[model samples]
Target: MRLTLSNFVNYTSFMKFHYSILCILITFISYSQSVFDQDQVIEKTMSQRWELDDEDKNGTFKLTFYKPIFVLPARWSSNPNELPQSESLENSFTEVQNYDQVEAKFQLSLKTKLIQSFLFGHGDIWLGFTQLANWQVYNDPVSRPFRELNYEPELIVNFPMKVNLFGIDLRMAGLAFNHQSNGRDLPRSRSWNRIMFHAAFEKDNFQLYLKPWIRIESSDKDDNPAISEYIGRMEANAIYNKNKHSIYVIGKNSLDFDKNRGSLEINYLYSVKSNLRLHFQAFTGYGETLIDYNHKQTTLGIGISFIDW
Candidate 1:
């Protein structure tokens, strides 16, 4: 059954997820003061990570974290869309297979600076790539095949800024060309391109990112028409870091009130040692993966993630 936003709010499992996050948040807030310096943590982290500050900036190219990279040993889905569908008749699948409800999932992402001070010694050009994959490792009958994999490559021109709005500090802004695809043949191939705008903000130990994109229309028969309705035209990611723990909330919306559709993802990361950390994730909505762009599901995952905010 497709899980709608209205029904998801009352879902027992989703309620449990919400409660767990609430408890975690409360615990973190309680201990936030004695554990870390909020101002330094927030400012230094963002500045160093994005090279927003001109002082001590590296001119040479070097790879860095662009997104969270994690491996989920066990990820459970409430409704696995075994038979994927698409608006394009040629890309729709009718065969339904009995796939395991639990699987292994992982994401690998990295970015590198390509040009420093490209725009009047202000903007820097960067190249980034991210890959997300779902593996049916425990499903022996299926021979442990990969259920889905999405590849995203981007080119961004980022600039540093100092602006404040309603007590929130705007740190940076950028423009990017993004391409995402699942490299598969007809009946499975899914791909899209976008010209996305980026804006980042920070205050205390909280950081927020707003990204809204305009889809690049293709003349070829589109594999997933109207994908924006499910995957969203814009997304916002908010991260709060205190001590060794970080909480992330990501929301995507189609921007249509009449046919409202979107997704929400909550992630908690506890640093175990160095950059390695324990990761927990809960997601409810559509477009969990490129192949499942139009499908809806609720999922929970526990695993290990590398990197710290």
Candidate 2:
């Protein structure tokens, strides 16, 4: 019998000193370089070319990054499917355990044009994973193993249309791919390869985003009986900012596990300088089906990060 335990990551500037505010969680990127990386970033994404803080006024080439991660182990076995009490066939742990994961990613942004206005084409890359259970019995044939890997790419067109919103920003991404090496890598090499299309409405402290997506492959082929397991998906995230942080809630549904699930997260960005900042975040709640199984999970974690904050 084969068992697989998987983990995932969150990448953005929280980890890198470059690319200021980037926190992406997956891969497959096109790489190239140019000048005015900073000014070019604000311009292409804001529909206005920017100059340096003091010297140059031309949008030149620049680089940015986001490297923030939140992971907790011990909690791995604390999943909804865990055997809360000691049973005839199993022994339970005496207490709770804590664990963590690491994440890192970087981006190269340049100014490009679309529809007579300056637009942005950002290339992002990330890598990381969470820690799994260390308990010995977890390896027993009677138990299950889980694991996950995620990657995503997005394309954006930020236009100018503002009066009250977060300065009016809209973006579109091309695709998001997630590969899995479940404890057993069972049935086949299963995963979620999705083609994502989205649009967002942003005004300083508020963001309204909607996404319709589709997943083609998965680990537990028989897990999703009602949804074809590989079809249409939907998700939403709304944010509200007050002072130095943003509070947001997310809802998601799709062909993958935990179809009807919601999440709440808090993002804290503390500024140290005009160009440097620190980021921290926390997550809770559960996903209905993890890796196409009757699984439930609750996650809690803390991370030290760098960003444009």
Candidate 3:
């Protein structure tokens, strides 16, 4: 069943989603140590991950998806993990494909400005959701599927500071209480508390951000994937703007040569009008394991994004 969700801010209010009904009720408290004097433009995206097949209920070679995230930043709210949605906000969902040893996801990202960003360092908080894909361990000659993590609610706390050259903006948060499968019919849940330090710098048309991510996954009964591990993620985005037409190129890499891998994309993001956007792009990279088998994709499309502020 598709769960419902609701918004949880009171300083300025609105509602979306149905997972929570009564509301989380968090008010915006002015920070005396805020680093800015003006509001920044709040950038947000409503997106989904769609795949070709559903996972098999019993143990089999089934295909599934990772979490489909709804990223709403806090110029819209002050609480973490409270991304609200409705049939009206956006209808963007990525298409997913599942293969025995490989899978693919096509992303349709939508953006909006629900709240005006405060200048300097305001609206640094964000909230989102996710469901891990079907990950399995098969040591036999024939490959069969086993359960990894099912689904989980995710939270984010980002402190977007002033962007400057030779300077880094630090952001950190935790992903608490996501679901996992334990052999039985019932599910086991776990939460990961993570803190990351990021260095951000941009020059001309290029933006570079480096993150040193640390993860601490708690165990329901002290198993292995429950310890803390550190991974390095480096992402770079370059944009070319010519009048009303623009291009965006992004490359993301993770130093964790194991389970978690990465991608590189080059696309065009343009404002067709005050309310319309045209997006087109193609990307080729690796998936869960880099360099084992190449991850290839070529998509040509256009969409409207970021209309309300």
Candidate 4:
């Protein structure tokens, strides 16, 4: 074929028209797929919580809340495990420690993004830590001691995206390597490691989180070989907010019908002032703490919550 000015001009016009159409389609898809809305409470909450939609212009290195921070002055337990024991016979305690039925409880949690836009452009890597403690503050004879402390550290690779099912919006999904332990020596020591898969979804004033994990086996002695049977294989957390009132429900399941075991926790929060809220909590079942992973108990607590308002 021979090149000509007339033919070249016609071909160029056709290509330009198709390019315009492609651009319009891209714009439409982006707009329709958007899951964040500033006016929607749940959407906005999650957006700011995860920094999913550039809601926070601050750098990714800033520390933020990974879990609720709360202190309960009075926590009453229905059944207190007098003899804390582990699956490993050597890790079991022979003597029972003096503990109070009613004690103080608190938790602290924080997270920071270590890397933004790694692996894939949209994925972010974050490091998080949480500590929960049970205090024998009222045990006068025992001389005020910390009963149990659980430390949790996580490395997460989070990916934010937009997907809708029914009326719920799937906001983000991630994979995490989690380690939880009690920094105690000898028979008191307890720990576990897991690789977890997590997802977040929101609808109206409610937000839900799902996490399913698989235990990481180690060659060393297993402190709690039956941890999953008691603590659980998966967890579900739901939060609902309305004005100054918020309610949270956290549940865990072992995923085995033959020997089912799990835990349920309910928390109620009422905002009293700026970032300060009155909190009430109730929990039942196993795995309240690393030392109590196989122990079943029910507890009620009254306290104050900080941040994530």
Give me the candidate number with maximum TM-score.
1
Better of 1 and 2 by TM-score: 1
Which of candidates 1 and 3 is the stronger one according to TM-score?
1
**TM-score (all chains, Cα) for each model:** 0.85, 0.43, 0.37, 0.84
Residue 10's lDDT in candidate 3? 22
Query: Could you give candidate 2's per-residue lDDT for residues 1-309 as a string of tens digits?
Result: 343332112123223422322223111111111222322221122212222112322332342331232222222223533322222112233444222222221222233222222334232222222222222222324232233332323333333333343456553222333332224333222223454545556555666667666555445443233332222366676765554444455655543566544444455554332222244444444332233232334443332222221
Weakest 10 consecutive residues of candidate 3 by summed lDDT: 69-78
Query: How does each model score on lDDT?
Result: 0.85, 0.34, 0.32, 0.84
Candidate 1 local lDDT, 1-309, one digit each (tens): 898986786477556755874584445444443444444332246778888898847775797768887878799999998999998989998889779999988888889999998768988899999999998867867767899999999999899988999999999999999999999998999999999999999998899999999999999889998899999999999999887788999999999999999899999988765445689999999998999899999999998776544
> Where does the lowest 10-residue lDDT sum fall in candidate 4?
35-44
Candidate 1, TM-score vs. the true structure? Answer: 0.85
Model 3 vs. true fold: TM? 0.37
Best by lDDT: 1
Backbone steric clashes in candidate 4, count: 0
* Candidate 3 structure lDDT: 0.32
lDDT of 4 by residue, 101-127 (tens): 999898889999998877757888999
Say which prediction, candidate 2 or candidate 4, comes out ahead on lDDT.
4
- Candidate 4, superposed: residue stretches over 4 Å from native: 1-44
